[model samples]
Target: MLDRRNMLKTLGAGAAGGLTLAGAAEAEAALTAQASEALGPYARPWSPPNDKDPHAQNIVALSDDYFVPGRFAGKTVIVTGCARGMGRMAAIRLAREGANVVGVDWLADEGRAVIDGIRRDGGKAVFVPGDVSENAVCDRMVATAVDQYGGLDAALNNAGVMDAIYPGDPIDYDKQKSLIMARIDQASDDYWDVVMRVNATGVFRCLRAELRQMMKQNRGGAIVNVASVAGLRGFGGTPSYVASKHAVNGLTKNAAIDYAPYGIRVNSVCMANTATPMVERAMQILRERARATGEGGGIGMIKTKSLLQYSDQHARDSTPAEQVAVMLFLLSPESSNLTGANYATDGGFTTY
Candidate 1:
């Protein structure tokens, strides 16, 4: 068996001493990490999600991006942003566990892929085409689940745009002026609005509508929002994504508190960088910068080296989307009493 300490030493070896040319470069790169301590958008006085699952059977929680069978038997679930990446992965996993899954996405083609994959695996899933930001669209998605699955027992609010990420470095003196001119310059006001509308506001709308229906059912429900590691921390690059998700965390706590009177459980799956579309886009942008600057030069060796390094980190940052879904199950009746918690599905990124 490999010793964890030695393993980490090996991993951090390349990043050692700031002596070699490579080490110096990585050290400089390391300084790009932000230290800003923005507060979490809101406080939690709410119920934790899936606080109910662990007691039902001998079922166990997944540690990585993997799953076991029957994790969510006899449940009806709605997953937003199921068109691609983690959302799609989660939707498929729920269906495989014998839940009726209602998937929503803006990407029609990718949405269909999720449905198709679920069906291929002998699981039930329905793809609804639309944006989660719109009340009408959100309403319709929920309606599809109720209309088809009898009633929604759990809803995973995983739909949201991840268009921004920290650049790992703050702006230099040359780039500081324009940034200082605007309060939301790093991510911009427009960027903030767009992200807030889709990521944070979408959750508010989704949970509000979900709770209203759950209240009508007079039955309890569980909800999980897809927040991020940045939500737990803060950002100097894409401040908006961080801000929006932090608001989501607050929304989860508040909703959990309000809805608990009616037995509704609300929580969030706060993740990190992962091999998702959002991270891919961020990497491409960084690589483009490297190319444009000729910093790493012709072969793009240094650029490739750094990009792959960051890419691997982001990939390791998140568990498989399905792995996080297990927490959603625990929030339901299976676990029996958990509520109002912010579960970190990050690969220890927040521990730092």
Candidate 2:
């Protein structure tokens, strides 16, 4: 008798045996249905926590109205930074949309929880715990997607770092301020190197791996890099972060130009301040600064002011789902005509 693991292995092997697109779709449906049957009634719908913090909202699930059911069926996708925030949401949505997902992150426990949650919801996914800064890890990510799901169809390069290499204690105001709001002259060698390694070089490495795999498969694929508004325009403080994001946008354009002949589409999402854990941590630091110095002008305030000036929406950060909506569109067939485009997911923040 075939166990669940062996059964999935057999299905994956069959998929890799050169099935046509239509045949692959049928196989994919059968795989999902059989996987669900293997789990029986124990499978349950997974939902994000109902947290009071806006940044923590929309962590696990996207709204039913937002996703096109089975849009990513038979496709294999890779998502980075899958432990939390936008990356987490992207992974969940991709699996929910019927994509076999390979989730990569350095946060092992949290990342595994995400993959486990997807499985619990009757979705196919696996977690690879490693930092994208390493080239070997990037290659392994693509390998996992292919080995587990037959082939790679898409990827969301969403892993990134801002401010500091490591988080400081809440009472360490001086350290936090320096890390979060340092000028170019004030930035340290360690600070610049860490940011570039993870943000700029990391995306480059991921793109290289994903593009190579798609090229080898001789089939078209889609990729969405999570850039930032800083990539489009300038921002005070966080020079390393801004420069790294600009590098991401540049890489997106270059890759799209070179790989279009291979039928691969590469694009990026330049987002403003979103309600993510990264932004929330920065906000906490700025709020502390405000209380200590009684000053109002900080990163959060500046972003809020800019958002209010250009958009009709409320003066607040965007939710993770809002950004993921744009990402999913770029990854799906709906945005086939778009390549090398650095789409601003900001609420009109970069217009002026």
Identify the leading candidate in terms of TM-score.
2
lDDT (Cα, tens digit) per residue for candidate 2, span 239-330: 88889999999999999999999989999999887888878777776677668768665553455434433322233567798789899999
Where model 1 places Cα greater than 4 Å from the true spot, the runs are 1-66, 164-183, 289-315
lDDT, model 2, position 279:
83
Give the number of the best model, judged by lDDT: 2
Q: What number of clashing residue pairs does each candidate have, in the order they appear?
A: 23, 0
For model 2, the local distance difference test gives 0.79
TM-score of 1: 0.68
lDDT of 1 by residue, 35-116 (tens): 1121122222212322444222211223332333455667788888887677777786676455789999878887888798
TM-scores of all predicted structures: 0.68, 0.77
Please give the CA lDDT of all the candidate structures: 0.64, 0.79
